[model samples]
Target: MTGLRPAPARVVLRGRTVVPGVVTGEVLVSPETISGWGGIDPATGTITEARHPLAGVCFTGRILVFPGAKGSSGWSGFFQTTRLLGTAPIGMVFAVTTTKVALGAVVTRVPALADLDDDPVAVLRTGDRIRLDATAGVVELLARTEEEP
Candidate 1:
């Protein structure tokens, strides 16, 4: 048998930068909106809202891909706590840009991108390995999950 293996599928997406930085991590997608104020436990980095699709999921270190933030302006504060607690997302790619999310991304101090040429929430799936270059406004797909095929 041949020793060579096929290269992983790759895709590059362009978007507007929210918080400029670079990061590489696995994607954790939330198809629905996330409310940081009453929706997540910053200490654990887990979505605590019962009805949320990503509820009970811990986003620490993952690149959070979601529609956008919901609820009150306090959302940013809660997200900042995650960063302080050392459990913040390594990056963020969202379809929508709200004050809450924009502020949260800034305070979280992670690579963040928004208004992608493609719908990030639809194109990016959980377990996808990506290099988020927010400064360059690029999201490079590095690998896909084994379960995807």
Candidate 2:
């Protein structure tokens, strides 16, 4: 009922929603390798590590799709800062559930889907538009039809 269409590469992830909202945005997939401390910049919303492939990139207004949270427990605090900075992502999809990410999502108050059975990393690509229905616990993909002016 949420107008979700079968994506070209379909995958399903099921989890609890820590935050509540309807969100749709580009997918930024990171496998189970995102380090909490260096993966994101709370102040600027830019990924700041040179070693990371996604360095210097911004997650503002995007759907951050990741397998799980890794490294520091300080992860939640960063999201809190980003929220204060007003540069947080629209939503998040996690293949596995973690308390760290859960707390972050709760604090940030952003729509988050987790505990997915399928690997969103494998099926979802960066820049792919994602439609997340938090109310129904469903995620759908719609083709990115270029930037709208």
Candidate 3:
């Protein structure tokens, strides 16, 4: 069917460093504003935001791409819980890093990236293979094509 075509043949992104590390993994994208406080279940890594596009989605072991984190100073606490629960994202790519999200990234102890040459959140899609180099502030992405299953 015409609607089933794949996209993102191949692409690379650059961004500012947050946590400073390198990692490669599948990505989970959040098209809606994410709140670290009530948005995710730390133990399961599931997005709990009712109206969020990625609701009920688990980002564990993936590169999480989101515009930014919103609401409550408790953001970092929840993310830290993710780390302790072993359900944390391997890496994070944020469009804008606010204090709360920044702290979350730091406490989550995962490689984090932001302020890219182009917004990684928009350029990347869910299920894409990504290599996040937070130390070097770069992301190497392989966009999927319709040819691949």
Best by lDDT: 1
Number of backbone collisions per candidate: 0, 3, 1
Give the per-residue lDDT digits (tens) of candidate 2, residues 1-149. 02323464554445565566788777777654565676788888877767776788788888888777777898888888888999988898887678898888888788888765567777677777778876667777775423221
Off by over 4 Å in 3: 1-10, 143-149
* lDDT comparing candidate 3 with the true structure: 0.83
Question: Candidate 2: RMSD over Cα atoms?
Answer: 5.2
Q: Write the per-residue lDDT of candidate 1 for residues 32-65, one digit (tens) a residue.
A: 9999888999889999999987789999989999
Best by TM-score: 1
Between candidates 2 and 3, name the one with more favorable lDDT: 3
lDDT of the structure predicted as candidate 1? 0.88
lDDT values, one for every candidate:
0.88, 0.73, 0.83
* Per-prediction TM-score: 0.92, 0.82, 0.89
**Decoy 2 TM-score against native:** 0.82
